[model samples]
Target chain A: MNSSGVRSVARIVARDDGRGGTALPVLESDGPLALRRTRGSGAEARVMLVGAMSGPLGGDHFTVRARVEEGARLSVGSAAATIALPGQAKGEARYDVRLDVADHAELHWTPEQLISAKGSDLHVTTRVDLAPASRLLLREEQVLGRAGEEPGRLTSRLTVRVAERVVLDQELACGPGAPGGWDGPAVLAGHRTVGQLVVVRPEFGADPVTARVLGEGASVVPLAGPAALVTAVAPDALRLRRLLDEALTSLL
Target chain B: MSRAALLVLADGRFPAGGHAHSGGAEAAVKAGRISGAASLADFCRGRLHTAGLVAAGLAAAAALGTDPVALDRAADARTPSPALRLAARKLGRQLLRAARATWPSAELDALGREFPKGAHQPVVLGLAARAAGLGPVDAAYCAAYENVSGPATATVRLLSLDPFDATAVLARLAPEVDRVVDRAVEAARQAVDGGVDALPAASAPLLEIGAEAHAAWPVRLFAS
Candidate 1:
């Protein structure tokens, strides 16, 4: 089913609740954050952030900003993959995630995979600004199609800026007539799902053993003593999720 | 060709832009993971076994005019880290630019078109070797030499090691390079005989981590 023209945004704050469950921090936006429930209910949760909504959108001309204040530990989860339906004109999704963590503040921004349906094109930019002693564990996963189906042709680009420097830049173009691309044993290993996790911690070890353990199908590369890049590839979206979760658990 | 040409092409000072990279050594060093030459040598050997061997095998196949896209994909799949992929592409582009100007041919041009902006180094070098009339053994040797010498030279520059001592280290690595090349040539031959898909897959997780860490550094000189 084609779900188009649906747009909404929701912001959630994470605070230590003195108990195990996190408390929602106070949001300081000029307007209220947008939230909407789809007319039909299914096993999956589909959320869209559009213009006039509180969050980011695919077609907005201006950049959207998200602020995470100090001592706030926010965990943002998506109901499911957000699809970029074909736009009448070229469309783009831009997000500037400004995370202002106080000393020992933790943030986990794990969203669902971004699915670009057939004929859909999108460009997404996510920036994370972290303060010293702030910790962040973020994951970006993308699936080209739905279950039991070959992914439709699409073009998607993701650029992540951490502390004002480009840490991750990826562009995928897959269509019926696109030029030479990822159809080989070495590139994807015939895997359809891929995920990247970036962890910024001050206590990480300098040895290759820790990095090795963190990397499975992914490459574990060190970026100083406090940062690391972990990547993985799997046959499906679920496998990718499981692998990343395991890797992160092992790291902790 | 003279052995000097082999030395020149494989030399750390060839200006192919390899010396600038530690082949993931900088990250390892920054992480305090590698402290001495022996540990550094061990890191180099691991890289040789994983990235080096796979790349050399792919280069040999590309030299025989295999699809550049396929070879590039194979290399990319093996390289899971985006940092390493970018590094390989940067080095590949520079190497191809120089090789095309120095030695131009139809096959090289074809491979260049297939690669366009983001070909990996091993694939380009393999194609360049074929264009330059070099055989599989020579191509494999060049691949192994570039892999080891890049890091050795980087270690010298990063640590300020004596040039004479660096040369001696390179000298010591020559036999290892030959051994790797021999194994790679055999693998290439077997893959060609058995089919490309029949080629083996190997990996060294530690190097992958080093590459990832290097990419995340706030300030770093090396690309990978």
Candidate 2:
């Protein structure tokens, strides 16, 4: 990656604080990625990502890694959307995220939208691995382009595993150069905003979630394992978020 | 190896229970997106490259004799829709049943017993091709063709589309299906040596979303 672009990494490690609270003993940020510990309630640690600079530009590489050990709880979010912009170098940008949750641990990952601006190309991969008996609530949302603008190219993949078994894995390619009909009625259907909510609980294995359509373009379906995935596509980001939130309200 | 067996396996009327599923066309029709042949072509092209490509890769890999258990996990990884997964397994169970009766391979018998509820349809399709003395390309061809044919044929019923026009839609997609099969076969070859992770994870979100909506319909012409 003769990246005339930036290469950054952000990391967090949460552990049991031993006084009935969660502790983040390691918080690291580099280059364009910044992390800060936020105030939280009992047993859960909170962290917010603050973009330090612009241009997760084409030709850049960035990674975010988070780990929660047994008995620890962590919730991570972003201050605002992360916009991918074109860079001087003519290369696609790469964003990789790795998350691990141990047995009896919990994590809520609700990052803000990722926008792919015109002339930009970004490939993003996110993998979340959970131990048996782990609990997780992950919300992932992507907005193809800013309002009133044609998107460049964006490909995103999310893979989740429970107890080393794949629970949900999917990839979405949108914007220009993806493939014919990607924006057509069979895929995005002219919708620029898409999102998914994955909730994994131990009890769900025995009780199980009832599969149903949540709204106009949304549905919650139970996975083969102890998890339920809610997916939605909307005209814009706000509607996408609303649909996912509504599903979440009834789910959790 | 056996082109005749490949045709037999790829036949749309193979008693695999696929006639009941629209492969998302029923939902697209209900949504007014697939009112005619042109729109159906658009829907099928999208499905062929994304979900179609991924399924072809899995099918080819399984035909190459990849471990079925691991490939099943890989299929689960590629499919996020629970409704689609359920439908694939149901179709797989039906396909395996037909394969055992037709080819009678010991391998097919073992796979059937292993996944009694069903495996993913693509995985079962590949195993069936292998049982019939077919190769990876044949398996990939069957998988890719089925992906488009299911939706194409279903539209003929849902929209009362002209059967000739519907068949022409598929005829036009034959070139793209060839390209997709090449890509799928290449990926499967790589996956055979590297890992199941090497398989294509192309996804069609609306297909997943549509499958869910179709499953919930009180009265529908297709099962998915």
Candidate 3:
């Protein structure tokens, strides 16, 4: 219970009009977070998430929930990088996101990078529940610190379930001294930029090109639902971004 | 119920198919992250805290009678490497055979029937601990110990760095291993009530990445 924090919620539900068309009937949002409809082709309803607040300060708690109704499609992105700063209480910021995709629904979530400032402690968790025939693509990237400074402590966790069966669950922690040995080769290998992209579908298989895109500093892990979970880490943010672009392109 | 059963399961030569895998030490060694005993100690310590802690939590939860299928999915979520997942299921299958032959429990049989190819090795190990009447903490200790021991043994073979040095490396890690088991059992106790979400999801990114690379390797001493 950190005081002096901003609590925001973005609830979005995309509905299908039955003619292969998608509509956003519910975009109830509050606080410093807003969801704006964007242009997309076909049945895909694309939206951009804009943060009214400059960034998250220490002790800020942000919650987001988005649901795609049966046979509906929704694609989400952010307007800019999420800059996180330390708060007054614990000097930490927290983000909890929940996503649900109904039967035959599809969701594409590709957000901008998260830049953790010095002395900032951040925790982010995203949970997804997918019904049968549903699909979800989620990407999370983080830059440890601003230029010339050591990155603050951050922990990111992602949990995905298909039909109430967990398929992809991964957590990465980075800090001066934390659960993940930040300096050790077994964890980050002294890299500051870390990113993970998860794709859940019914017909997932080995993609050699995807494997090659995930080259040396990254990996492509296949989950139980024949889904693909790709993770990458690099000393440079731009380098990681290029690799992620290639990997995501292969998935397309 | 049987204190000796913990030792039996913890033994490296239990024929559980762990011998074929180096717990990522082979890759780390080849990557030059581990050249000597000190670096190997660091590698093993990191694995013990992250993957080791998470595995111990899952095993303890399974030993507490949590659903093996659910635990298997949780294990899958925690593991982000397909190659490592394959290795885990392979080890799980091998461990199931030994557990059924040794303990002969219906619970183990049900798990085998459910995951014919295999469950994650830690899930099977936890259930095997249950069938052997061991507690969650006992299972956690077994998992934590194996996490470090596997890498140490593998490093000894990979580097020819002297078996005695590797043995000393494990002895040095005994204290941390105990702490990991304690934390894992505590998490399992919470998971018994809060569900599998209460378990730890700590991970070692390089281990996952290295396993994927190692899987594509044309030749290697260990399977993962």
In TM-score terms, which candidate is top?
Answer: 2
Pairs that collide in candidate 2 are none
lDDT, candidate 1, equals 0.59
Query: Which run of 10 residues does model 1 chain B get worst, by summed lDDT?
Result: B197-206
Model 3, B1-224: lDDT tens digits are 88888889988889898888899998888888889898888888889888999999999999999988779888888886778888999999999999999999999999999999999999999999999999888889989889989999998899998999999989998888988898899989998889998898987778888888888888888889
Model 2 spans with C-alpha error above 4 angstroms = A1-3
lDDT of 1 by residue, A1-252 (tens): 222322333454445555443455543322323333223222222223322332223343323344445554555555546654444543443333344444556666676786655554455545566665667777877676566555544443333333443343334444333222232222243457766787876464334324453433555555433566666766788887888888777667
Which has the greatest lDDT? 2
Fnat of each candidate: 0.03, 0.68, 0.66
TM-score of chain A of 2: 0.97
Highest-DockQ candidate: 2
Q: Cα RMSD to native, each candidate?
A: 16.7, 1.5, 2.6
lDDT of 3 by residue, A165-226 (tens): 78777777787656534557678777788888888877663332234326678876666665
TM-score of chain A of each: 0.67, 0.97, 0.92
**Residue pairs clashing, model 3:** A58-A86, A58-A87, A169-B77, B1-B133
Badly placed stretches (over 4 Å) of model 3 are: A17-21, A205-213
DockQ each = 0.05, 0.73, 0.59
TM-score of chain A of 1: 0.67
